[model samples]
Target: MEQQNWSLATYCVAPHVAGTATLQGARLTDFGGLSVPIHTSSTYKVDSAEQGAVLASRKGWPELRKDGSTAKDEFFYSRWRNPTVAAVAAHLAALERAEGCLLFGTGMAAISTSVLSAVKAGDHIISQSSVYGGTFHLFSHYLRESFAVQVTFVNIEDLNTLERYIRPNTKVIYVESPSNPTLRLVNLEHIASIGKKHNILTIIDSTLATPINQQPLTLGIDVVVHSATKFLSGHSDLTAGAVLSNSQDFLKQVLFLQQTLGSTLSPFDAFLLARGLKTLHLRVSHQNNAALKIAHFLDTHPKVKVVHYPGLSSHKDFHLAQRQMSNGCGGLLSFELLGGREDGRKVIEHLQVINLAVSLGSVESLVEQAATMTHSQLNKEDLSEAGIDESLIRLSVGIENVDDLIEDLRQALEYV
Candidate 1:
C-alpha cells in the first residue's frame, strides 16, 4: 500500500498508501480523488461459479504466503471482507510491520477472537493482572466459565516467575504493556523469548502504546491486537479493532474466526480508520511530549500523591520503559489524591479543558477515576489484586498546548 523504504515517521504523513487503495477498482476513475471510497456493497459480483468458489474458500492475503501457487484477492461477502476494510487492514499492517492484519467491529471482538484462535477447551493461559477490564472479564468469565479454559493472572514485573505459571497445556501468554490505569510496563522481548522457549503464543494488546510507541511484533511477540477507537482513531468518532501478526498461520486463524463470528468493521468506519492512521505518528508524538510535561506538573502538585506514568523518574518502570517504548511512553497517566476518591472526583469535575470521560487517546484531554470508571467491572477484592486505588485519576493528554493543559490541571488541583 505504501513505499517500503520510507521511515515510520515519514510513512505516517505520506499520502501515497491511502491514495493507491482508493484508486484501485474505482468506479469514478476520472474523479481524481485522494480519499478512500467507502465500498457500501454487501456482496461482490463474480464472473462465474468457478471464480466464486475460489474466492469464497481463500483465508488470508495472497502475497504474504511463501508457496508459489497464486491465491486470488477477491471478496464475495461483507462478512468475509470488504474492499474498504481491507484497505485499512493493509494500512495497519504496514504501520505495525506485520505480514497481515484483520479488522473487527470492536476491541473486545479482536481480543476474544485472537485468544480463542490460539487455544480451546482444556487449554491454559497466563495473563497480566493489570489489564483492561473487558479483557479481564473475558479471561475470567467468558473463557474460563464458558469453555473451562484455565487462566492464571500474574504480576508481569517479575519476569522470573512467568515460567512457573506455565503448564503442559499452556498455549498462550497474554499481556498488555503500559497497562491500563496503572501505567505498568512489560518486557515484550522477555515475554516473547519465554513464549518462544516454551512453544507458546504471545499476544499483546498494544492499544495504549500504538505502533508509533511500541511494535510488539517487532520485539518477537506472536500477535498484536489494538482498540483502534483510541489512538488510531484520534478523533473518537469511530469504533474498531485490529489483529496483526507476522505469522501468516496465526492471522489466518483470526481471519477465519472473524468471518465466522460476523464481527466485520463497517465500510464507513473503515474509511475513518484509514484516515486516522495517516496522522498517527504526528498525533501520538505531540500527545507524548505533552503528557510527559503534564506528568511532571502533576508529580509536583501537593494534592496529588503519586503519578503512574512510565515517563517520570519516580515511576518504578522508568528505565524499563525507556528500553521498551520508543517515541514516548504514551499519552495516558494515572495519579492518586491525598483525600482519596472525593478529591479525585472534584479534580475531574473542576477541569475545564479536559473532559470527564472514560476512553483515552484523543485530540482533547480526558480524566476519569479508574476505581469507578474503566475498571469498575472488578470487585473490591479484584481491584486490590489488580492494584487499582480508589483515588487513582487517569489522564489522557492530547495535542493541546502543554501550558494550557498544565494551567487547566493547576486550577483543577486548586479546586480540589
Candidate 2:
C-alpha cells in the first residue's frame, strides 16, 4: 500500500478552530475517512535490519510518501513513537504555535521529563510560589532532596528583585499562569523577557488557561507544558500530558527523556485525546462564559470574602490576564468564605449539580477546598504563601447552563 501524505490540510486553519473540519494532521487512508485512525501496533515490521536500524535511530526513513516527503522519525517502537500519538502532537503543535510537541503518560510525566531534560543534579531552578501542588512537590522535594538541585520559589511580581535570585547555574524559570486554585496570573511577557535576557529557559504550565485562551510561546516563553488530562482532554476519561516548544532542540531533549522514562501515551489514550481536542474551542468558550457569570455571582455574595478570578475587575492581576489571555480568563475560580472552614464545608455538602471532587476542566462542574485537596501536601506556612486558606473553595465551571450553575452556587452559599 502506498502511503499518502499526512501533512496538514491546505486550508489556512486558525488555532482555536478545533472542530472536525479543521482537525490538522489527519493521515488519509485508502478508505478516505476523515477520522484519525488509531495505530495500535506496538512495533512496526521493517523489510530489513538496515531499515530497522534507520527507524530506531530516527535518521530519516528511506520510505517516501506519495508527496515526495520522507517519513523522518517514522514509527519503530511504541515506546519511542507512534502514528496516532504523532498525529495528535501535530495538532497540538499547531494549536500551541510550537515547533514541536511530545506526549507522555501523565501530566507529571511531561513536567518531570521536560525539567529533567534541561537540568542535571546541581542545576538551579526559579519557580513561582503558586504552581500546582504536584509541580511544587516535584521541585521542592524530589528534585531538591534527590538531585541536590537548588530551587527558589519567587513572587513573579517582584520583577525588580528577581534578578537577585538568579544564579549563574540557573537553568529554568518555571511558572503557572492563572495559577491553580488562586487564579493568580504571572506577567508572561516580562517573564519571557527576563528568561531571554538571562539566557535561561522559561517554562509555563498553561493547563488552567488552555491554548484556546493563551499561547505562551507567542509571548516568548521557551516552552509550554500542559496536563492534557485537564482542558486538553476536556473530559475525565483519559490521562495524558504534553510538552510543546518552538525549539526543536528542547523538544528533542523532551522526546529523548520521554522515551528513556518510558512515559509514552498509549495509542487508545492518544486517540481519545485527539477526539477530545476536536471540540476544544467549543467547550472552552462555553466554560469561559459560565465561569465569569459564576464569578460575578460569588463576588457579590455576602458570604464570600474574596473571589479570585481574572475576569473580575477586582482581581489583582486582571489587567495582566487581559493582556496575556485575551480570549478569556478561563473556567476556574476560587472564593474565600467569610465564615471560614466550617462555612466552606457546608457549601460543598449542599452542592447538587457540582461534584465535590479534585480535578478540573471537565464537562461537569467540580468543587474542592484547595488546602485539603489539591494543595494538601503544602504545609501551613507554604499554603499561606500560596494564598490558599482553609476557607477557600475552588470552583471549576463546566459547560452547564450559567443560570443553573449560579443557582446551585446560590443555594450552596445559602447553606453556609
Candidate 3:
C-alpha cells in the first residue's frame, strides 16, 4: 500500500486546524485507499537475525533521555508500540500542541502509568477532592497500598488545604478540570503556578474538557492526559487514553513506563481513535452549543435546584471557565433534582433521547446518577466530602438537535 504523499503538516494546514490535519494523515495512498488501514500485525519483520536482536533490544529498553525518535526506535512488537497507535498519538500531540504523546489501552492505563513514571514509592501526591471514580480508587486504594505513596484529596478551591498539606515529599499535583460529575473547574493557571513554585510536576486529566474546548498545557500545566474514549473518540464505541507533554523528558518517562506496565493501546482501538479525531472539532462545537442551550433550559425549569455548567452565569466559576476555555463550556453538566434520589430515578426512566448510562463525549446523550453509577466506589462520607449529592444527575449533551433534546428533558421533568 502506498502512503499519502501529503503529510499532516506538508501543506497549508494550520495549528488551529489540527483536528482536520489529523484526519488527513489517515488518507494514506500507501494503503491504496483513503481510510487508515489498520496495521494489526502483532510483530514486524527484520532484515536478519542480527537486525532483529538490535531492534528488539532497543524496543525492550528505551533511551529515556532521547528527545526525537529515529527509525531505530520503530516498532518491533505490538506490545511496545504499533504503527496505527503511533499515528493516533501523533495526531493527539498535534491537537494539544505537545512535543509528544503516548496512547494507553485504557484511561486508567494512561493515568496510572503517568503517575508512576513521575513519582516513586514514599513520595506524596496532592490531588483535587473530586475526580473520576477510577482515578480516586487508584490514588486512594491501589497507589497507597501498592507503593506506600501518600495521597491527599482537597477541594480544588481550598488553596489553603492544598498549601497546608503540601509536604517536602510531595512530588506531584494532580487535578481534573471541570471535574467529573460535578463540572467544578480548577484554576489551571493558579494550580500550575503553585506547582512551579514548589518545583512539583502538575498533571491534569482534561477528559471532560477535551483539547477542542480546553488546552491546559497553554495554561502552564506540565502534562495533559485524557480518556480519549470520551469526547476525543466522539462516538462511544472505543476505549482509549492519551498522554501529552511539552517536556521531552516527561514524555520519555511516560513512554518507558507505559511499555514497562504493558498497557499499550491496541492498534485496532487506536484506528478508531484516529477516525474520531477527524470530526473532533466539529463534534465538540456542536456539543458545546447544545450544552449551553440545555444548561439554560435546566436552569429555568422549576424542578431543577441548581445547574453546574460554566456557561451559566449563575455557576460559581463561570468567569474562571470563561477565562480558561473560550470555545465554550464542555458538553457535560450536572443538576440537582428537586426531590432528590427518587426524582433522579424518575427523570432517568422518563428520558427518551438521553441514555440512562455512563460515559460522555459520545454522539448520544447520557445521563447517570453520580453517587450510584460513576462514583459508586466512593463511600457516603467520601461522596459528601467531595460535595456530590445523591440527587445529582450528570448529563452529557450529544450532537442531537438542541430543540429535540430540550423537548425530551421537558417531558422527562414531568416525572420528577
Candidate 4:
C-alpha cells in the first residue's frame, strides 16, 4: 500500500486516530472546514468487547500511542483523554518545545497541579516574592495549611538571597518572570542552573511572556506553566491553563494528578485555546510593540513616579529581559502615580477608552489600581515588600491604536 501524508486536518477529521502528534502545529483553520470537525462529542461508541479491552489496556492504537503503535484500543473516556483536548495539548507541547502538555480549567489549576504533583509534604519550595495574588495566597496559606508544604519567597534578582532560602528539603523552585503587577523579571538560566545544582525541579509561570516571547524550558528550566486565560486566549473569551515539561516521567505524574484531581479543561475550552494559540505569535508581537511605546510614554510623564517595564532602560531587569526573551518585554506594565493612591483612583475613574478592569491580556486596553484590585489580598507590609505602591496602576496594553491609547492615558493622568 502507498503511504499517505498525514496532516492535522487528517488526524483531526478521524479523531479515533487521535495521535499525540496531531496537536504538534497549527492544524485547525479559521473556517469550520478542515481536517477535523469539532468533536463536540462527550462519548464515543465501542465496536466490540476485544476493542474495549484494547482501549483500556496500557497500549492503544497507532493514533493514540506516542510510539505510533498500530495496536487498536486506547481512548476509553473523555475525562482521561479526549481527542479534542489531546489535539490541543499536543499542539501546545510543540509550541513550548516540551515533551508533553496538559490542559486545565484555569491558570490556578495548572499551577496548583504542577506544585502538588512535584512536591510532597515536608518538601520546600523557593519562589519569587512578587507573584500573582492568587498564587501568593495558594503558597502562603493553602499549601502551607493543607499539605504542610513550606515555601520561601526570595528576591529573584539576588542570587545569594535565593540560595540562602533554599533548604535541604527543597524539591522545586517556582517563579514568575516579569512578575504580576510589578513587572519584575527573573533570570531563567541562572535559576535553572541553581535548580540543577540541587537536583530541584524548576517551574516558571510564562503566562506573561507567552511562547512567542520566551521559552523557559529551553533555558534549562524543567517545567513551564501558563494561564492561557491571558495572552494565549487573547480575546479573554476562555479561561484555561497548561503545563509543559521536557521529562516524560514528570509529564506522566502531572497528567496523573490532572486526571485524579478532576481539574481537566472542557473540550470546548480546549478548542478555543487551540484557536487562540494559532494567532499567538502575531498577537504577542503587536502587544509588545504597543507596551514598549506606552512604557516609554509613562516613564517621561511628569505625574508618573516610576515605570515598571523591562522594556524601559531604567528598569532593573531590562538587560536580563533582553537576554532571555526573544521578542521584547511584554504587554503588561505598571506605573506609580505621583499623587499616591488618590491619583491612581482618579486615573482609573477618568479613563474613557481604557476599561477599568481586573484581568488583562485582551484586545482592548485595560487599567486598574493594583494595590486595590489585583493585589488587594496582600497586607500593607507585603505590598510594600513586593514593590506594589498605594499609587501603582497596572496596565494591560491592547492592540488598539497607539495614538488613541496614549491620548486616553494622557487625559487619565491629567486627573492627577
TM-scores for all candidates: the values are 0.91, 0.93, 0.93, 0.90
- When 2 and 4 are scored with lDDT, the better candidate is 2
Candidate 4's C-alpha lDDT? 0.80
Candidate 2: pairs in clash: none
Runs off by more than 4 Å, candidate 4: 1-4, 7-32, 47-72
Q: Write the per-residue lDDT of candidate 4 for residues 1-416, one digit (tens) a residue.
A: 99765544334323432223233343444354533235566666778977777766635523322221111134567766777677677666666666667889999999999999998889899888889999999999998999999988875566545777778899989999879988988888988999999899999999999877788999999999999889888887899999988787787788778878989889888878877776676777788999999998999999999999999889898888889988788889999977999988999999999999988888888889988998899999889777789999999998999889999999888877
- Alpha-carbon RMSD, each predicted model: 4.4, 3.2, 3.0, 4.6
Indicate whether candidate 1 or candidate 3 has the larger lDDT. Answer: 3
lDDT of 2 at 203: 96
Residue pairs of candidate 4 with colliding backbone atoms:
9-35, 12-36, 13-36, 23-90, 23-91, 55-74
Residue runs of model 2 more than 4 Å from their true location after superposition: 1-6, 9-28, 58-73
Worst 10 residues of 1 by lDDT: 21-30
Clashing pairs in 3: 1-30, 2-29, 2-30, 3-29, 3-30, 4-29
Model 3 TM-score relative to the real fold: 0.93
Per-residue lDDT value at 80 in model 2: 83
- 87-121, model 1: which lDDT tens digit per residue? 66766776676777888898988999999999999
